[model samples]
Target: MEAPPVTSMPVTGGAVNMMEYLLQGSVLDQALESLLHRLRGLSDNMDPETFTDHELVYLLKGQQGNPFILRARRSLSHPTSPWHLRYLGQPEVGDKSRHALVRNCVDVAASHSLPEFLNEMGFRMDHEFTANGHIFRKGVMKIVVSKLSRILVPGNTENTERLSLSYLVELSVLAPAGQDTVSEDMRSFAEQLKPLVHLEKIDPSKQRH
Candidate 1:
C-alpha cells in the first residue's frame, strides 16, 4: 500500500535549537533482568510497550571529513504511523557534561516511498539495521532498552542477525530549546538504574576517534 504525501508541521519553541537529553550505556546479558526490574518500578505504568523498528541511515558525503546523516525508520508492529525521517546534526564540541548534548534536529513525516525521495535528494544508503526494544515513559522522559541486529540483506527487513549479546540502554527526552530542567530529571532517573547499567551522555565525536 502506498502512503500519503510527505508533510511537515512547524514545531513551537524553536525546535531547530532544541537540545536533546540523552544517556547511553550497555546492559550485560546477566544484568538485563535486574535492569528490567528496576525500570518497571521507576516507569509510570507497569507494562512497557514493545516495538520493532527497521532503520536505514543515509549519508551525504561532503568535502570535509564530516558527513550529513539522515535516518529513516518504520515501525514493524504499527502500520498506521507514518514513516519518520530524522536528521540529528553533529554534537557541539567542548561540552562533556552528562546532562545532555545540544544539537540541531529536524524531523519529517513521509510515506513509505521515502527511500526513493531520499535518493532523489542526493543521499546514499550508508547502513541499515533493526532494533527490538521495550519503551517506558515517565513524564517527558523516554527510556528504551534496545537490542540491535545487523541487516543481512539491503531492503529486506526480515533478514537480520543479532549484532551482539549486550543490549543498548538509552534514556532521552525531547523538549523545546531552553528547557534546562529536563536535564536534571533525566539525571535523577538515570541514577535509579545505577549498577545494572551506567547511563551517561557519550560524545559522538569522541566515539568516532
Candidate 2:
C-alpha cells in the first residue's frame, strides 16, 4: 500500500490540512540573468539563496493504482542541512476557476539515512538528478529557478550532463486546503514575470504519452 495520505502524516502537528498551489514555466539559458535580476528586486530582501542538490525519485509498486512515488533530496552545497522528502499528488487541473494547479503535498525533513530507510521500506530508486538553482520568497509564496542535470553514472552526482539549455521555473505556495486566495497571489506574481517567462498551470498528467 502507499505510505499514507498527507492528512495522516503529521508533518505539522495540527488538525489543519495543507495543499500546494503551483505554476510552472521555463526560461532559456540566455534569459536567465535578466529573470534573476527581476526576481531579486521583487522577492524578499534577504540575501539570494542558491543551492545545489542531488535528488532521487523512489517508487513502490502496488497491485492496483499508480505506483507510490517519493522524492528524496539532499543539498550538495549545504551538506549539513537535513535532507528533504516530499510527496506530491496528481495536480488538479480541471478547475478553470483557479489560477494555479493545486495538489496534495507532504514535506518532511529527514536525516542522511533517508535512502537506506526508504530501501528498507521496499522502495526502489527510479532515477536521480542534480538541480542547481536559486530560491526566492515573497510572503508565503516560494519561487524556484533551476537547471537540471542528468546523472551519468548511477549514484554519482558529480558525473552529469545538462538536461536542457533552459531553466525550469516554479512558483508555489503551501497553504491550508481551503485557501483559494493564494492562487490569486500566485497569478499576480506570474504576471510580473510575463514576457520573460509565461507561467501556467501545465498538467503533467496530460503531458505523459
Candidate 3:
C-alpha cells in the first residue's frame, strides 16, 4: 500500500556544504555499481570477525550515492532536508506522546521486506540517513550505504541470485519534532513489532502460564 506523508509540518531547506557535494558526486553517483562491485568482492575479501561496528557504521555512512537518494537532498549532510520520512523495522524509545504518535503512524505501514520476500510481493523500505548522537550534525543527512544481507540489506548474501537487498538508505529530510531524530529507529522498530512482536515488563520467560 502507498504510505502517507510522514508529517504535516511544512518543509524548508537551506544551502549546501562542500562535504555534501563530495559524497553526492563521488559515492552517491556510483552506488549501484559500487554495491555490485563490493558484493562481487565479498567472496574473497569478506571477513566476518575482523569487520567491526565502527567499520559497519563507516560502511553504512559512506555508501549512499544513487540518483534517487540524491534527489531527496542535494547531498548527504546537506544544510537541510527535503521533508520528513520514516522506515519500518527500526527501534524507538521516548516520551509517551511522541512515542504514541509515531507508533500510530507506522501501524498503517508495511514491513520493509527484502531478499526473503524477493519472490513474494510486499512492502519495501528506504532507510534515509542523517545523524544521531555523536554521529551527525544538525540538519545534515549523513549518507549510510549498506550492502545486501547487512543492516540496510538484511539476508544471506552467499547464495541469493537476486540482490533484493539492493536499495537506498531512505532518510527523513525534515521532521517537526525537536530531538525526535534520536528515536526514529527505535520508534519505527517498535511500531513494526507492535503487531507481531511482544514485550514484557519483566522477563516473560521467567513467568508461568
Candidate 4:
C-alpha cells in the first residue's frame, strides 16, 4: 500500500510559538529517547539481586547527576553527601534540574554559539559548565528550562509536575511557609525570559516580593 504524501512544511499557526513547536518537535523526540533509557533501567530495579553493581549505578546515579532521585551514598563503603546537596533547598528545585543537561541537550544547545539568535529571542547565557574542557553557558535560561521540564514532564513525569501551564506555575521547589519565596520568585523570572528553558534564573527578584 502506498503511504500518503507528507508535507515538508514546518508546523505553523495556533498558539504556534517557536518554543511550543520545539517542545513538540524533533528536539523533543531526541529528549524522550534519553529519558526512556533512564526509566527503563529504573524499572528493572524491582529485582535488584539480578543486576550487577555497575548495572545498578547505570540505572541509579551515585552521588550526582539524576535530579528526581539522588545517590544516597557515593559508594558502598563511603557515605557523606553528593556535595551538590549543599545547594538543595527542596525537591522541586532538585527535580527541576534533574536530568537537565542529560536530556534537553540544553548543554548541547549551549554549544550552538548563537548568542544573537538566543538574544533576538530575548535569551542570554549565564550558567556555564565544561564538558571535556569546553565551556557552555545557559545563563538565566537554565531556570526556564527547568520550569518547562516541569510542565512538559518529559519522560520523568512522576517527579516533574505536568499539570497545565497555570497550575504548575504555582508549583515550585521551595518552602511554602517561609517568609521568603525565592525559588518560586526565581521560577517566575526564568519563565518570563522568553523560553530559553531552565536547568536554572534571576537572583534579585528571586525572593519574596
TM-score of every candidate: 0.85, 0.92, 0.20, 0.18
Question: Which ten contiguous residues of candidate 2 have the minimum total lDDT?
Answer: 1-10
CA-lDDT, candidates in order: 0.79, 0.91, 0.26, 0.23
lDDT of 1 by residue, 86-201 (tens): 87755543443437654556677889889999899899999999999888899889899999999987778788999999999988887665675787888888888887888887
Q: Looking at model 1, report the run of 10 residues with the lowest lDDT sum.
A: 1-10
Best by lDDT: 2
**Which residue pairs clash within candidate 2?**
none
Off by over 4 Å in 2: 1-15
**Compared with the true structure, what per-residue lDDT tens digits does model 3 show for residues 102-124?**
21111111123222232243223
lDDT of 2 by residue, 26-104 (tens): 9999999999999999999989999999999999998898899999999999899999999877667777788998888
Which of the numbered candidates is closest to the native, going by highest TM-score? 2
Ranking by lDDT: 2, 1, 3, 4
Which regions of candidate 3 fall more than 4 Å away from where they truly are?
1-139, 149-157, 162-171, 177-209
The residue pairs found clashing in candidate 1 are: none
